[model samples]
Target chain A: MATAAARTFALSAPLPLDNGQSLDGVIVAYETYGELAPGKDNAVLVCHALTGDQYVASTQPLTGKPGWWERMIGPDKPIDTNRFHVICANVIGGCMGSTGPASPAPDGKPYAMRFPVITIRDMVRAEVALLDGLGIERLHAVVGGSMGGMQALSLAANFPARAERVLAIATTARHSAQNIAFHEVGRQAVMADPDWQGGDYYGSGHSPDKGLSVARMAAHITYLSETGLTEKFGRNLQDRDAKSFGFDADFQVESYLRYQGSGFTRRFDANSYLYITRAMDYFDIAEEHGGKLADAFAGTPARFCLVSFDSDWLYPTAESRHVVHALNAAGAPVSFVELSAPFGHDSFLLDVPALDRVVKGFLA
Target chain B: MATAAARTFALSAPLPLDNGQSLDGVIVAYETYGELAPGKDNAVLVCHALTGDQYVASTQPLTGKPGWWERMIGPDKPIDTNRFHVICANVIGGCMGSTGPASPAPDGKPYAMRFPVITIRDMVRAEVALLDGLGIERLHAVVGGSMGGMQALSLAANFPARAERVLAIATTARHSAQNIAFHEVGRQAVMADPDWQGGDYYGSGHSPDKGLSVARMAAHITYLSETGLTEKFGRNLQDRDAKSFGFDADFQVESYLRYQGSGFTRRFDANSYLYITRAMDYFDIAEEHGGKLADAFAGTPARFCLVSFDSDWLYPTAESRHVVHALNAAGAPVSFVELSAPFGHDSFLLDVPALDRVVKGFLA
Candidate 1:
C-alpha cells in the first residue's frame, strides 16, 4: 500500500495569464502523498525552491534520489502526509519533466534560450491552473521556503480564497540588493563558459557544465553562514596533513563545493538556472500592487506565519520583519519569528525542530 | 628633471624567515618617488592589492598607464610622494616580475606549480628585505588598502619596529567564512578548466584564460556593493530595447562583468590567483598571535589609522570595528573612522576627497 501511495501524475493543460499570453501545452510534473479528505479541505500545496522539482514526497526520476523535502513531508513529519493530502509540482521555467527552456520549441528543437522569460508570479499562475485542472481546490494551507515561499506569498496575494493558511520561511517579498548582486555573478559565470555557445549547447554534444558548476558553487556559499562554513571546513586540508603546496583542492570545503557544483550540472540545465534566478530577482510583491506591499494582501484571509533565521544574511530577519509589517498594516492575521540557526539562508532545508513544530502547529 | 624623478634602483636580495626557510634571489620590482629624508625616516612603503604590482607612483611598463595609486601618491594627495620617499614593490608570490608560480624554477623551467606556497607574512618578510637592501632603517608609514591593507597589517604585526605608523583600509584581520567560501569557488573555477592541466600550462601553449576570467569576475562582484551595482546597471538592456529572450548578456551588468573577467585574464596568471587568494583565506591575525588579537599589536608603538567605507560589505565597518577594538585593548594609539563613500569596497581606489584628507592628516 505504501509503495502504491507514492504515485505521480502528468497533466498537460493551458494556463491563461492576465497578460493575455497563455502558456500553451503546459505539462505539470507532480506527486501527491496520502489521499484527499472527503471534503477536500485538508489539502496542502508545497512549493519547491530554485532547481527543485515535483518530487517533494517521492523519488526523483532523474537522480533516482528521494524528494528534496523528504525531511519535512513524511508520515510523522511536519506536513504529516498521513493526516493531510500533500501536492507538489515542478514549477514553470524549470528543467525537470515540466515545461522549461530545455523543452522543445515550436520548431521541435530544444528551446535552449527561446523559452519565455517568466517571473515568480507566472510560475504560481501555472501551478494554480494545474490545481484547477485537477478538480482540487486547495483548502488547507500553502507552505514553502525561499523561492517556494515567494510562490506561496504570490498565491496568497493573487488568490486569497484558495488557501486558508500560508507559511513562508526564509523568504523576501522583494529581492534585496545583495541578493541581486550575487545572482548577477552566477549568471556571468554561466555566460562566460565557451561551451555555453550562446545557450545553444543542446545538440552540440557539450554543455556549459563548468560554468554552471562555478555558478552553483558561488551561489551555494551564499546559502550558508560564516559560522557554518568555519565549523565544517575550518581551513582543514583535503586528504592531507599539510598543504599540498600546489593547486589541488587543498581544502575540504573546496572539494565539497566542487562536488556540489559538478553533481548539480548533471541534473540541471544552465539556462534554467539563469531563468529561475532571474525570476526570483524580479519578484517584488509591492511593485505588483502599486508600490504598496499591504495592498497585495489587502483583504487576504489566509493566516500567515513567516520565519527567518538569525544567520541568514541573504534574506535576513529584517526582510521578514518588513513582510510582517505589511501584513499587519493590511489587518491580516500574521505571526513572525526569527529563529537561531547557523545554516544562514539555507536553514529552511536543514534540521530545525523549531521550524518543524511551528509549521505543524500553524497548519493544525 | 622628469628623467631624474623616474630614475630607480633595482634591489635583489634574500629574505630569512622565522621558519628557517628563506626566499633566495628575491627580485623586488619597485618604484620610488621624491627623496628619502636624511636618516631615511620620511620613507613610506605602499603595498598593493592582489593583481597589483610596483609603479605605484609612475607609469606602468606593461600597460603603459598611470600607476594604480596615482590618485593617492601624487602631489597634494594622500601619502604625498612629494613629501615622502614612497616605495611600492611587486609582492612575493605575485606574477608582476616577482617570485611567483610563473617564475623560473631552480632547474630552469617555469616554476608553474612548483613555487613554494607563500603567505602574507612571507610577503612582508620579502618587503622587509627589500627595505634593508635599499638602506632604509625605518619607515615613517606603511600604507595599503584591501589586500595591500592586509600586507600593511602584517608588516605592522610581524615587523613592528620597522614602521612608525600603519594605515590599513578596507581590510580584515582574518578571512570570514564567506570570504573563504568565495575564494574556494574561484579556485574551483580555475581548476575546472582542463587547460589548467595541474598548473603546468606553461609549455603547453594554452592559458587557462576562461577559468581565470570567471574567477576574476566572481571576485569583482565582492569588491562591489548592491547599491553600487544597481546604481551602475539596473536591469538595463545591453545594446537593445528589450530582452533578446536569449542568453547573450541581456543586462549591462553582465556585459560589464564579462569584460572585467576577460580583461583580467590577459594580465594575471591563474596560478597566482589561486595562491594569493588561498594565502588570504589562511590569514588570521589572532590565530597567528595566540588567539588574542591584541597580542598581535601588544607592546608595539606603531600608530594606527583604520578607514572603512559605509557601503563596503565585503569588508564592512563591523570588521574595522573589530580591529579597532583589538587595537584599543592593546593600548595602541589608533584613529578609526568609517567614511561615507558610494564606491563600496573599491572606494579606497576611487576619488574620495574625505579619504585623502584623513590619510594626509593621519600620515602627517
Candidate 2:
C-alpha cells in the first residue's frame, strides 16, 4: 500500500468553456492509481480543494511531504484505490502544472493577472474533457471537499449522467457575504505586496512570499475552530514560560499560524491565490439557474451525499443543510449528515473516521 | 438640522492608560453639539468605530462630507444632543490629530510602527483621561457601535462606575476567530507595502497608500450586507453594458469598492491601520477578567443596552447575543435587541430611524 505508484498524464490542447472562450494549449497534470475495471465502471474521480494538486497519494515534489489526501486514498482507506480506479488532477486556474495564472502566456511570460477568471464549473468542464480524452464514458463516483466540493457539485449539475454517485463535503453551493469578504481580504493582501508588482512578478527576481504567507495564515485560521485552537494552544507561551511582551509570536497558535503561512508561500503562487479566490467569490450556481438553487439540479440522476462538520464556520452545517434542502426540493436522491469534528471547515482533510466510513459506504 | 454647526475642541495633554503607558503631548480632536447642563450630569459620550474619527456631526476636513454618525448624533436625533452635552473624540492610535502611528515621536519623526500596541481598553482609558481633563466626573451615557461598542462595553466592565448607561451596538465582548483573521489580513496588507519599509516611511519619499487602500476596500465589504449589495449592484456593468473580458473593475460593485479604497487612502495612514487593527485583534475582556466572560462584569453598576443588525455578519446578532447572555449570567442589568437593518453592520452609521429611537430611549 505504501509503495503503490500512480501513472501520470499531461494534456496540451485548447479546452473550451461554456462562456465561449477557449483556454489555449492547456496542460492538465493528473495521477491515476490501480487498474480500471473491465467496463470502466469502477472509476472514481477525486477533486482537490484550493491549493491542492494531483499528488493525492504520492510525495509532493515541492514540499517533500506526503500527498494531501494520503489519508483517504490508499489501500483499506475510504476511497480505496486498490478497489476502485482512482484519478486526481490539478484543476485549471491553479499553479501545479495546470493551465493557470502562473503559466506562461503565448509570449512565454507568466500569465500573471492575465489568466482568464475560471469558475468551478469551468474546472469541472475541463475534467469532463479529460475524461472524454481518456475514453471513459462514465464515472462510478465523484468525491471532494471544500472548493473541491464545489467542483463535484458542478459536475453533477452540469454533467448529470457522467457520474453515478456524488459526494460533496464541507462546501456551499454559493459564496456567502462572509465568504466573499474573507476572500477579498486575502486578495487584498496579495495585491498589497509590493513584490507582487501588479501580478507581474514572474521575472522580477522576487515573489510576494510575505504577503502570500500572511494571506494563507489568515485563511488557515478559518479552517480551524475556536475550540480546536483553544484546546491545542489557548494563549500558551511559545518556547518560553513567560510572555515575551513583544511581537515574537508570543502564543503557540500565533507561531503555528506563522509557520503555516511561511510554508504555504513556498508551494503556492501569489497570482494563483488571487485568481482562485476570485473564482470562488464569483461562483453562484443558484443565480446561474435563475435564482432557484434547486433549478441547478433539475432532473439530476446522480445520488448525492453531503457531509459537514459541526465546528466549521467557513461552510457550517447550515450551508450543507441549504444544499440538502435544495436537493430535496429538486427531488434528487440525497443523503446528508453533519459530523462532529473540531477542525472547522477543513475537517474533511483531516483523519475523521466517520467521514471515511460514510465515503466508503456511500461509494459502495 | 441640515446646517447645524458643530463645536470643536483641541486639547494637548499627557494621557495615561491602565497599562502604565503614558502618551505625552496627546492632541484630542473632538466635535460636539448642544449644551452642557449646569450640573454636567446630562453628558452623552459618543464613541466612534474603527476608521471613524470625532466628527460625528460636522463636515469632515478630508472629504468635506457629512460626519459618519450624523444620523444618530444630531439635534432631535438618537441621543437628543439639544438636551445633552455630546462628546466625540478621535480615538488614540488613530490618524486624525491623535497620538497614533503617524504622529511625530519624541525625536520629531512620525512614530510609524514605533507606536505602542494599544488595546480597546487602552483607548477607553485615554477617553476617561480626556473626560477627567474636561472636568467631567462621570458620563450620563456612553454610546458606541461596532468597535466603539466594544469600548463602551469595556468601560462598563473595566471601569464600572464611569458610565451610568452604556449602549453597545453591533459588537462583541471579545474578538472572535473570524474577527482576528480579518484583522490579520489587513495588517499583512500594510506590512507588505514596499513603501512601508518596516513601518519607517516618515522620511521616505513614498507611502504605503496602495496597500492601505486595498486593505480598506476589503474591510469595507464586511460593513455591508449581501442583500444590500445585490440590490444596489448585481452583476451590473460598471459603465459599459457588457463584460469587458478583462480585469478593469468590470462590475459596478468592484468599481465602487475601488473608489472607496482610493478615497480612504487620502485620509488614513497605513501604519495607523495596522496599529488599530492589531489592537482590536488583541482585545479580550474575558482574558483580562480571569478567563470568564461573566467575571468581566461582576458587580457592574452600569445599565447596558446591546443592539445588533439582523444582516451584520461582521459582528452578527449571534455575537451580541453571546455578550448579552454573559451579562445576564453576571446578574447585570442589560437589554438586548436585534434590529432589522438592510445595510448590515454599517447600519449603525446610516439613517436607521428605529436605531435612533432605541439609542435615545436607552440613553435617556
Candidate whose TM-score is highest: 2
- Residue A219 C-alpha lDDT in model 1: 91
Residue B28, candidate 1: C-alpha displacement in angstroms:
2.0
The numbered model that scores best in DockQ is 1
Docking quality class, candidate 1: acceptable
TM-score of each: 0.89, 0.90
lDDT of 1 by residue, B126-203 (tens): 788888878898899999998899999989888889999999999989887667778888887787787889899987
The number of the candidate with the highest lDDT is 1
The CAPRI category of model 2 is acceptable
Which stretches of model 2 miss by more than 4 angstroms? A1-13, A104-109, A176-178, A225-248, A251-253, A285-300, A310-313, A316-331, B1-13, B203-205, B225-245, B289-300, B316-332, B340-342
Worst 10 residues of 1 chain A by lDDT: A1-10
